[model samples]
Target: MQNRLITCTLLLAALGGLSACNKNKGGKSDVTGWNYNDGKKSSGFYVAKPKDIKTGPGLVFVQGGTFTMGATQEDVMGDWNNVPRRVTINSFFIDKTEVANVHYREYLYWLENVFQDPQYEAVVKGAKPDTLVWRSELSYNEPLVEYYFRHPSYNYYPVVGVTWKQAYDFCIWRTDRVNEKELIDKGYQNQNVLKQELNGGGQDNFNTKSYLMGEYQGVPGKPKKNPLKDAQGRPRNTVKFEDGILLPDYRLPTEAEWEYAALGLINENPSPRRSEKQRGEELISNRQMYSWKNDGYDNLRATRKGNWQGAFLANFKRGNGDYMGTPGGLNDRSAYPADVNSFFPNGFGLYNMSGNVNEWVADVYRPTTNQDEDDLSPYRGNEFKTVDVSGGEGNLRDSLGRIKYVNENDSSLRNRFNYQRSYAVNFLDGDSLSSSSYGYGITTLISDKSRVIKGGSWNDMPYWLSPGTRRFLQEDQSSSTVGFRCAMTHYGAPEGAGSKHKTGNFFPTRRQKR
Candidate 1:
């Protein structure tokens, strides 16, 4: 009409100068997935996108050193109550085993098929686990109290009497069934919630960032005939520690990170000339109250298949009419099943640490807890589901009568250390040996019946299997000789390998003298 309106007003003024240079290059392209950049930043770096690390939760680590934790001068039972001391531990991760009984009967069969709905069935029958108090008269444990926790061949042993708050509520139902199988492998659950609930339980929703952004959905939460594709198609989960993905919180090892990881002495490795002498042992040093040195297996040294028969690494009941082998040879399946990898793992791989059962440690019994504990990683105790009314979230108690402490930095306390009052204390620093006492501060007139307990049971006696023998009960006790194992801390390590001090060596070599 006027040359077609001047070529439609010059194509509407070149589409209004391409929409004002995309509104000065930032108003974001009118929506459809918008973009004037900041899609969580892709170039100046901020691309963490996270969540892909998923697997099945594996990690085991442990490391750290500076031993002499409690009694390893061979402990002839002067019952000095785990004296020795020294201390230092850090680096963490655990759970190589020891939470068995068919993985807590799949958390009591998913809390009895999702609390059979009777109004959340008393929190699923109070998440069961009093397996009829592992029954016994003098013996004849009634076929392990009627088929060892519903037999599956005792599904890899270890799960005895429970309690340490039922293995911390089975590590919170194994971190909510591994983040609900990473939210139904990313489709945000539509099925496969452990094979369609296997009878009950299902509606958990699940959507972990649309499977960390790939957009998962092989039918899981449904949708994606082609919705951007990728959708968590690969990573099944469990390699753990490529440097992320751990959040589940089972916690509980702090009696000096369980006697500095039951003194495994950070499992060696050196050789690379940091003053390389090779044999005199310096790089990773010694320590070792029981994680390995009585040898038998886990090879910290003895290369080319040479050492390790020194045996007696753990599984007590020996030397006084002995139990596991001699006395009519092979009694009660060699005295209530040993070999859950027999023994020797410490320097962080973990394993029995000293003997077997006898664990529970979150510390609370304050026998003046080594002057005032906490060089770092130190611990006292608390249980009532580990308190945490929020305020700082980490939580610690004390002040009902007072004793708390805290130093090394004091960001309002998560851990600095100090604890020791479950009866039996001379300690102003005195015990462990006697140097005219100087424990510096010491306090604990008795706080509700002490607590701490560490590696060494299976009917104990190898000098209480030394991992710094200090014992206690009442916190709603439970024992088959006590059992517990779970820890986790190492979250990245950069600030000078997360607080330095790796070199080792200690135990009976001499120190407790004061």
Candidate 2:
């Protein structure tokens, strides 16, 4: 009886140690040998063990890997752009479909309602898509110009006539809204915010940056129990970066990331296996000419075994003067731009990758991008900026209830040499041309304002359907065939926080010593 009691006491002590290990996950600081992350006022660094990254609404994961980027077919246009090169892209999140008419309308509605004061009319106007883009001298596209964006029938169609700048602004707006909702859900923010505050001529609204910096104190007394507490149990107003609550900002995808995602080559690898014995060779079985996984079939993305078998795969012009097809048996069915989610998705469950509309990417146009870009997560367009503090204004925001920024030049930036050198590395050539208004039809049609656009449109031939095909347009210019989607960076693990057998190299977890 005495021996059993002693063993039981020892076991209880061991369990107690294990519980303490979990409670003090940061362990002790090696230098001072003091407990870290303890809920104390002095000598404590708080660290929250947050859950794994959550996939944001309307986004799909694109696992990264090495792939050949650039023209896979004959360069009949002879632009000499998109030269073949091997590059690796880091994992990221992108919209499952193009930004639809309804989504953009929601953005516009908020802008119009919030910025209603006449002084801010231009702000609302600038965000509007140029509905006039559908008009042409040769063709009578007047009806489309009047109805495409506003009409209820076309709500799900991909939004066209939006400039890259407008799309970028939309992304910023989306990030704030998403983060704001997250805080509200976590009881850090008040739910019943006032209407006047949202549209106040002088009052700023709840933005992610301003909230983090303690500028916007949201509506209080909404939730019964608030979780934001300090050491003494007083309510804390602001959330910190280390909280792991707010998600990364939404932005445009880099050229490499876009191309690699469009390819969706993960389908080439073997399916999930239980053990090493069941696992097949790790290899891509075939190369893809279009976004879909083709197996020597002309109709790559069509339904093969159903009533819709051999149906046209993507929405593109069949030939000159061939938009849809002969009356009854229509080819691809889409005359102009179809609904954003009309077609079949690729291996990544991304819809309309090669058709319906060309999507904007975050890269300055360069014919030799494949040659100039870095092998790892390559991109060209970069304007390194810091929160504008030049006038000692102290983290002030512009009229849009957002943070202002200035270029990280020698004077504005803390690290002068770093900014200029990094600019030289990626942003020099583009900035030089941009500073001079692109010389406007002077030396060349291409300019710094020109940005890379990918995928084919409703009016494009099959040549443009290939994922490797590339094109460019001015950043401020809107087009009837050009639309865009948003992307977000994957912060922690590239393969994501998956099980040992899932994301990365499979390894058995070592058992704890008995």
RMSD of each: 25.8, 9.2
Off by over 4 Å in 1: 1-46, 49-66, 77-89, 93-103, 107-140, 147-158, 161-176, 181-192, 195-258, 261-356, 359-454, 469-484, 493-514
Let me know the TM-score candidate 1 reaches against the reference structure.
0.30
CA lDDT of each candidate? 0.51, 0.76
Q: Pick the candidate with the highest TM-score.
A: 2
Put down candidate 2 lDDT per residue, 1-514, tens digits, no spaces.
Answer: 2233244335432331232333444566455656545546335444444334578889998877789898888899998888889888878999999999999998887778777888888998899999999989999999999999999999999999999999999999899878878877876666655354456433366777666655556674434554445665455556665556787789999888898999888777756345444654467667788888764233543656777777877899988999998999898888999998887788898988988999999888877667766799988877765566544443467777776766556554555654443243235344553332345498777776788899999989988988899999999998999999999987544555433223445467898899
What lDDT score is found at residue 324 in candidate 2? 90
Question: What clash count does candidate 1 reach?
Answer: 23
TM-score of 2: 0.86
Per-residue C-alpha lDDT of model 1 across residues 248-366, encoded as one tens digit per residue: 34566677777666665544543322221333244545545556643334332233344443344467676565656555443223466454555545555667767667778777665
Model 1 residue 398 CA deviation in Å: 50
Segments in model 2 whose C-alpha atoms lie over 4 Å from true places:
1-37, 40-44, 194-203, 220-228, 231-235, 272-282, 296-303, 391-395, 411-419, 422-440, 498-514
Q: Count the backbone clashes (under 3 Å) in each candidate.
A: 23, 0
